[model samples]
Target: MSEDERATAEGMQTCWSDSTPGEIHASFSGHRTLCGKPVIEANPIYASRLGDITCSKCGGIAVFDEGAARTRVREVLDKWIAKGKLTPASATEMGNLAIDVFPGRAFTSRRKGHSWNKISTDFLLASGAATDKDASARFVGELGLAVFEGLQASEYQGKY
Candidate 1:
């Protein structure tokens, strides 16, 4: 089989236990989730569907309780505050970043998929790349794996 075919046959990647945590939301700050290597996100599909989940930014793999999520947020804020990255007032302003989401609320994002137009993933799986059921959609400025995998370096004429 072809390389792309081989990748597609392996199916979407459901395990995020081995991945580095990505951003929780693109709307707010670009803080990292405390997943590190969380297990619940090993099966993102299952995690995202549940409530009272943790805020690991692992999306489908947050395993902590609400209290834990709150604590985690505080910890992150503390670290940032100490580093001068955040102040008490700024932290309080974005207090609900990930601390308050739980117990019927899940901290996850849209599914990861692909598109021919590279604009929507609702149509098909990403060729030569594993689909992440829990990963947030690829944002601008970040490299597009599917687009980059098969192209020549010289082909990057300032656009994908």
Candidate 2:
């Protein structure tokens, strides 16, 4: 028999099917030993992808489309600026940082090379928007929320 036939006889098999829009199908394959009790495990792909928008490896279901995320982040920053929580210049800086952090942008980079947290902190310091520790923490927390909302929104749209 051919290698594939042998593998099938040995209880190894693979299957593929069409996935919904904005998603991909992936599967795992491994050996299954009877005596040694070899184990095989598989997990469903639980993340969505659209163009450059996708969940981080560790982000699980989190996902975001580039344009929508950028617009959402900018709107949140604008609200903060209007409320006097952040200066216009600081808001602009934060908006720029968001653009860089989100996927589908040329500036997108992993946290290793360009960390969103570090960039937000630096922007706050340089812009003098939230120099105090408590204030800075709160500001960063707000940014985090904005990002989360953007991601969730994208995921919802991708599903339907």
Candidate 3:
């Protein structure tokens, strides 16, 4: 891991109930989390992709803090600006690029779910915990997907 990554992980270690998240069920049962989002079942096809329960909005508070992520995004933006690939006036565009790294809900014939593959560094130069360079895009992309899937799991701890 990189120095910055090590520092952030050490600083804000999550308070999960176990080394791995618990509380997944075999089927959807219309249960709702404390935060009111309908608890969803583990997407078996991708369960291997996640690490814990989601809906922590009510299961627990994650604080939604992105201090380190913001710092990195700005750093990437500055580099892009310096390369003349962007401009000082591109603050709005920079913000949009940053936001694009987050996974969004998607629907398939079977169910509605987050698009983990979409959360890559190809379009976004940086996220709250990831970055990209031509030489590191592959590793960064995989890491970004893993981090996002874990976040998805933690965010939905309401129950499967």
Candidate 4:
């Protein structure tokens, strides 16, 4: 079989295992290549070592999340709080920007009696590269295995 055909066949055969803990097989993250011809992204960092996920049209970082905006605003608010930089009025203004700039993009979900959000594993799994049930299951299995293996490795290192 040809290379692409062979790769596809291999991917199809891979299965997730709940019992095992090291990457059982290659993940979609490792196996699949982005489709279409790639273009040069205008991002300052993109001009350097661009990865496969770079956008084909604009050569942008192909951000699935509003990570940059969130990080910047968070850092600013944190810095202001650290330096006692914000007056009551200024704090209110920056706080407004913080809430409005990345509305609905917050990684954390509101919890009972809590003002901040927590990470959602469900959201992450849902947004992964795999589209179908089977593919997703397999990917999750392989990922679980990888994580388990890493934990074991770390434990072993600590013992030595």
User: Which candidate should be chosen as best, given lDDT against the real structure?
Assistant: 2
- Which regions in candidate 2 have their CA more than 4 angstroms from the true location? 1-63, 102-133, 156-160
In order, how many clashes per candidate?
Answer: 3, 0, 8, 3
Q: Candidate 2 lDDT (Cα, whole model)?
A: 0.43
| Cα shift from native, residue 39, model 3 (Å) | 20
lDDT, residue 97, candidate 3: 41
**Model 4, which residues run further than 4 Å from truth?**
1-64, 87-160
Quantify all predictions' global Cα lDDT against the true fold: 0.31, 0.43, 0.35, 0.30
Clash pairs (backbone) in predicted model 3: 53-153, 54-155, 54-156, 54-157, 55-155, 55-156, 55-157, 69-128
Candidate 4: C-alpha lDDT = 0.30
lDDT of 2 by residue, 50-89 (tens): 2222223212112233445567778788877888888889
Tens digits of per-residue lDDT for model 3, 13-81: 222222235643111222433233444433433332222334333222222223334444555556656
| Decoy 2 TM-score against native | 0.38
- Sort the candidates on TM-score, descending order: 2, 3, 1, 4
> Lowest summed-lDDT stretch of 10 residues in model 2?
6-15
Measured by TM-score, the strongest candidate is 2
Candidate 1 lDDT over residue span 90-144, tens digit each:
7655545323322112222222223223432321243222354432322111123
- Candidate 4 lDDT, 1-160, residue by residue in tens: 2324322211222222233333222122323222222222212232222222122211111211123333444455455556775555764465444333222232112212222212224333554524446644543433333322222222211101
